[model samples]
Target: MRVTIFNYGAGNLFSIQAALRKEGAKPSVTKTGSGMKEADALILPGVGSFDQAANSLPMEEIREVIRSGKPTLGICLGLQLFFGGSEEGRAKGLSLLKGRVRRLPPSVKVPQIGWNTLNVERENELVSGLDKEPWVYYVNSYYPETDGKWVVATSDYGVRFPCLVAEKNFYGTQFHPEKSGATGRTILQNFLKAAKK
Candidate 1:
């Protein structure tokens, strides 16, 4: 499949691209909106502050992609950007999904950077072959706070928060599937399968 990786200036594009390639996908890394028109699927990958990434994104094109119902996946900060806004910065997000990204409570480690188990709350194409609960890697200080309507999975640090979310053709993961080993690969493969449908 032709997967377009959106590089909004602060993402781990190389690793994400490499992972997609390993999954047997043709990934094109682009900072501009040029080739998005031909994408079978789009991935928004990020590893920095929410506002920085939000400000750099080509929203109109992204919205068009979403409107077309092409499968789109967001990773890490990319997941945070799916919300209305974030506490990490003043810039607003794509607002494709309802909610805001908030800083993790002070009770837990600032950035929970390890393997955490995923509590699958609902069945979706994103976690097709996983167990009821599976372990995935996460590296973030903020989590999306919503009413659990779009949350398909949750992970607990000190507080249970959204981990994997899906709304129509859009899907997001708070963890880095590219770095999460076998389970992660399965998630990506599932996403590709969903895209083909």
Candidate 2:
């Protein structure tokens, strides 16, 4: 299926493209709204600050995509951008999910870089074929503290935070599955399969 990886000038688009292709998906990366609107599935990937990523894109079209109820996946800053607001910036997001992003406290590393294992909290389509303690790559400081229902997985560093999230047509991961090897591929494959449904 054709999947468009959002090319909003911040994410590691080529790596995400490679990951999708590895999952047997015919994927393309673009910054245009029309390309995004016509894709069978869309992936929002980001690799920078919240405000830089937010202000650099067409927010209205993105909101419309989420509202369309088609399958969409977000990663890292892309995931953080789905929230109402982020402590990383004063600007607002698509608010597709109800929550605010906050930076991890100084107790641990600011970026929280490297491999960490995520514990599946609820049975969801995202981690369907993955192992119980899946090690995923991460490079972020801020995360969403979702309420009870939306959380699909949790990972601990200095403290536990939402790692995988799913709500209807929308899905997000705080970790980078593209960089996580086999376990990461499983997560992306699951997303591709779920989008077909």
Candidate 3:
């Protein structure tokens, strides 16, 4: 499968590309959203702050493509971009879903780096074979505060927040699947399978 990873200039591309390759995917990187509509799947990788990444490319055009039902996966900051805006920046998000990205409560550290457990709250193809409470790698401070209708799974820090969400063909992971080991690989493989259909 041909998968395009849209670079937000500060994107973490290598690890994700390697992960995609392991899943039998032909992964390529693009700084802009050019030709992304042609790919079997698209990824907005987890890296960088909100404003810088949002401004690095034409998100408006990219948003249209994603809404067109092109299979999409967003990780960390990439997932935050699915919301309308974020407390992290003045720039707007794609607004594909109704919500905002907010920082973790003061009770927790600024950046929640390390492995956290995924509390599967709902069923979806993304978490198909994951443990009920699988541990996944995370390197993030902000989390998406959205409706339950869009949330497929959640994780707890100072508060329980959406960790996995699916809306039509768009999916987002608050944790970095590329670094989450075998469990992460399963999630990506599921996405590829769904995209192939």
lDDT of model 2 at position 116: 93
Q: How high is the lDDT of residue 179 in model 2?
A: 91
* Candidate 3 local lDDT, residue 28: 86
Better of 2 and 3 by TM-score: 3
Residue pairs with backbone overlap in model 3: none
Please, what are the lDDT tens digits per residue for candidate 2 over residues 20-108?
A: 88778899876665687778888889677777778877888888887888789999888888898898888779898877898898899
Q: What lDDT tens digits, residue by residue, belong to model 3 across residues 1-197?
A: 99998887554589999999988899988887777978999999887889988889689888989988899999999899999899999998899998899999999987999999998877788889877668899999899998767799899999999999998999999999999988899998999998988
Compared with the true structure, model 2 gives a TM-score of 0.95
The C-alpha stretches of model 1 lying farther than 4 A from their native spots are none
The residue pairs in collision within model 1 are none
Model 1 lDDT tens row, 73-189: 999898888888899999978889888999999999889889999998887878889866688999999999987668999999989999999998989999999989888999999
Give the TM-score ranking, best first: 3, 1, 2
Residue 163 Cα positional deviation in candidate 1, in Å, after optimal superposition: 0.4
lDDT of 2 at 35: 82
